[model samples]
Target: MPLTSVEKDLDALTMTITADFPVPVRRLWDAYVDPRQIERFWGPPEWPATFTRHDVFEGGESHYYMTGPDGERAGGLWLFDAVDEGRSFTVRDGFAREDGTLNTDLPLTVMTFGFEETDGGSRLVTVATFPSLEALEQLVEMGMEEGTKAAMGQIDAVLDDLRSFAAELPVAAQLIGDTQVRVSRVIRGSVDQVWRAHHEPELMKQWLKGPDGWIMTVAEQAPEVGGRFRQEWTREDGSDGFGFEGELLESEPPHREVTTESMIGMPGDPARNELTLTPVEGGTLLTLVITYPSAEMRETVLATGMTDGMETSYARLEDVLV
Candidate 1:
């Protein structure tokens, strides 16, 4: 209930997972960082792991892919946080599209993974905090505990693979795209829930992805042409990065809403983030059209985080909607 061994839930509503492994915290911590060591044990029964890449660090990322024991493949980001050497680190856990592309429709999750040292071995505790109650229940029903166990098992296997696989690969330089990211996702929640999920500041924080210090400044709803729907994204760490700022191009409240321009770090005047909604699946299909005014602007924004960061965000969104 508390999600850890320390507390219990009187409400009996929340879902939290705690597990121990036959290893030391130091060894476990090492396994988490060395992406090469992660691919071995990340999938469930009959689901084998497939590695396209693994990069883990502060501000760095890794991706662990699973080819189902049935030969199905899924990829997501391995972003870390709260990393204490020899102790444990947390991963944001981002999701990727089928062909290993970022699903812009999803926001990253703020999942906390820890490796604590014990006398016998190490105790690993993974707490995936959901943004809402619906999110928490959905994850539990979706077999989050069993799934995590499988993924952790994969982590163990990854450590084994590190022995045979090449350990060192040069990191790739930041690359932005000439192709704009046009993305859409269908969320499975009532219109009110989806509207509340996006329009509420507290709800936004649970899924918004970025480096530390990433915060949303606004989430107001005004249904008018000249009306403004402004949101400023900030970083906890003092990096002058661009965030979102937009004006309500059009709005129909719970039915549909659109923004003309939304930019990162700077005002939406130069850059734009457009959000459109259509009723679908008894919920809504959220589509985003983000336009970076200049090539440099696009590249600069994309340069800040790893691809997994986006994946983890999407997974969180999936967690909430389901």
Candidate 2:
């Protein structure tokens, strides 16, 4: 086991767990910050996790759930209190309801995760402070200690698999839940540059074209919360034309944005898209989480070769950045 020790202080209402990994501190840190990597080991063996939203910055929030073997699901939430880049982070952790809201009936804890380099690898020290002694006892009784150890035990495999999350890889999409998908890519540009490329009309017109034969005809940015944005594309031969428009619900500028998207001429409910940008080792890690109206809609969208088209656009984006 990678776990070095587990300590509990009833007097202080805190529990600390230390684990060592056979990788550099940066590698270890990225595994936790990236939703694509963390979801692989965040839950115990029997209860695999799916993160619908994971934002590692301060004031950010993450919502995830673990599915049991029999299809039972338990949800969780984390409110980031502080972030020190690759070194450490603090969060308010608590149970979440099915609607992704905090479950006030359950106990909440303030957890701090500290990362440091050791002789050959790195170490992670997690300290969780309970609000009361009863809360501490409640969580321990619910198998939090054993469950955490089981979760950490699976991290070694993820850490050793480096190529899967490398910067050179193309765009990849993972199903988060029945109605959500998380699309991830490491764009070959700084975070600010990438954000600008996405928001600026001229820059977007240059690289947001999905495939070789398609051209972006319109790129109207939302610019601010409550604003509306529209994008249209046409085939080279002027036959197939399509467009999408959305209202910006939230904007965090160079870090995060939330928008509602709908096909310009098509019918149905709009999709909620949450985009986040983070600086990583090689470039900017861009994550787009989309929530569809239903599972059928989600599957229909993915079946249209969406990921391949996204990969093509991102490859073009790299050249535009250069």
Candidate 3:
């Protein structure tokens, strides 16, 4: 999270600010396009902005107001003249009245925001052109430069908050005939975080155990396509233990994974496991489906209270994520 560099050029009657954000271009673009997200970081550090109307397309209009420390309201407007999704946009920014109308007596600046993908993440460049040097000086005197920089500084935290919302506990188990058992839950984090928790051995060891007394000592994973993994579970006394080995048939980071799981103690056949992560409103919906060779095999596992074990394990997983 580098500080934005603000450059004021009175000779050109323009001001430009450039900053690098350690997030994807889409995330950076959303700061300018999405009203809900924009409101979180659209003003100075202390003076927060609230949007009343926001339409982020070409020829659209946005109306918002920033609240001062003493409860003073400063209304502003953005009239979009051009828009290129995830790329660039140009808008006219000016003072507005509280009733959602522009105040012609105030100065206006035409601002263009450009987003570009960088080696690390994304770079955002904003250029504001004023009608004259007097207007530019007026804006600078009004603390626009410092206010805009402070607003941009909040982007990193806002993006993190957007990804780390509350989780929803899904139905522990749904038995679909004899062929499948679905275990699903919504984790309160990004798709990448959830995926890494499942794919990486260190994160997996945090929550992949069954009962209270059992400990997962070994978690070896090769998380690429055609890779293999093994998980070993042991009791506190080291008297009772079992393990499962699996091969990844399909692997898609932050999305889906298909694998074949074979338990060491199981007498019958191996199970095909499919884990899918879908991006929902607040977090990721992780759906784990276990398919058996036959209905009898599924019934046998269900009768062993596998659903209860999964429910307990997933409940413990909440702690790991938070």
Candidate 4:
């Protein structure tokens, strides 16, 4: 009843209409067969309903009725050829008269329904095969394409909401690369001044909180190119905080310092943030290079989430330096 897609083949003037839905193929098939559920949005729900027969099995006959203010009647029937539970099926749809007799004006159609997972999501693909492309062209001239698009648009929105209700944890990561969010602020403080803040227990409490369940037992640093340091942020509730210790890549007192944290001892998975401090214009320019080992890893240190925390640390650093 709802068309999701219509891919055109202009070379042969052929088109394939598809509706990839989140619903199981069997559920979607049931809606096609059940007149009651079909009434919700089938064609138009504003029309009045007339008592009709609904037979939704392979060999059952279906008869339904609709009446308008102007005494109009519209109904259809489908003979299901196969019903596969939760998979796919085929059906033949045709129009019928008010008295349940077949209408010759309606063309019988063979619709193939498919259920699959597309890009980690469920999709129901339906394709109606016509007798020939000429019939398809004739329907195109009758504006079938436009109507189908409108119907499928509604169907897609419904399906999208349905899928959202299912609730999958969306993966979080920077849409752009990690370097994109990193900011470098040059300060006039010497490396010893920065290094002192890095190791101060009071300073640690002011900024970097350790893993959610862990506390920083120590904040130590070895000021050398190959030196290693360990810092921990602790929660009084005995929960963990985000903290790690990594080797220093480069170091020059009052000049530049680079360090890395594998984040093995933190609340989240492993990632590296390279912090650089350089002397510039009688001050030190601090460049932070946050290397997310993976997209998910990178999101753990988003600028938005870390803004307040980082600012707190910077303020504390200023206090200690001044």
The estimated TM-scores of all candidates read 0.43, 0.96, 0.52, 0.40
Q: For model 4, how does the per-residue alpha-carbon lDDT over 177-209 read when each residue is reduced to its tens digit?
A: 323334444444765566555556666554444
* Local distance difference test, candidate 3: 0.77
Q: Which scores better on TM-score, 1 or 3? A: 3
Better of 2 and 3 by lDDT: 2
- Give the worst 10-residue stretch by lDDT in candidate 3: 162-171
With candidate 4 superimposed using the best TM-score fit, by how many Å does residue 88's alpha carbon deviate from the native? Answer: 1.6
What would the TM-score be for candidate 1 when compared with the true structure?
A: 0.43
Comparing 1 and 3 by lDDT, which wins?
3
CA lDDT of each prediction against the hidden true structure: 0.53, 0.93, 0.77, 0.52
What RMSD does model 4 have?
23.9
Best lDDT goes to which candidate?
2
Arrange candidates, best TM-score first: 2, 3, 1, 4
* lDDT of predicted model 4: 0.52
Give lDDT for model 2: 0.93
The stretch of ten residues in a row with the least summed lDDT in candidate 2 is 173-182
Candidate 2 total steric clashes:
0
Best by TM-score: 2
Candidate 3's C-alpha runs over 4 A off are: 164-322
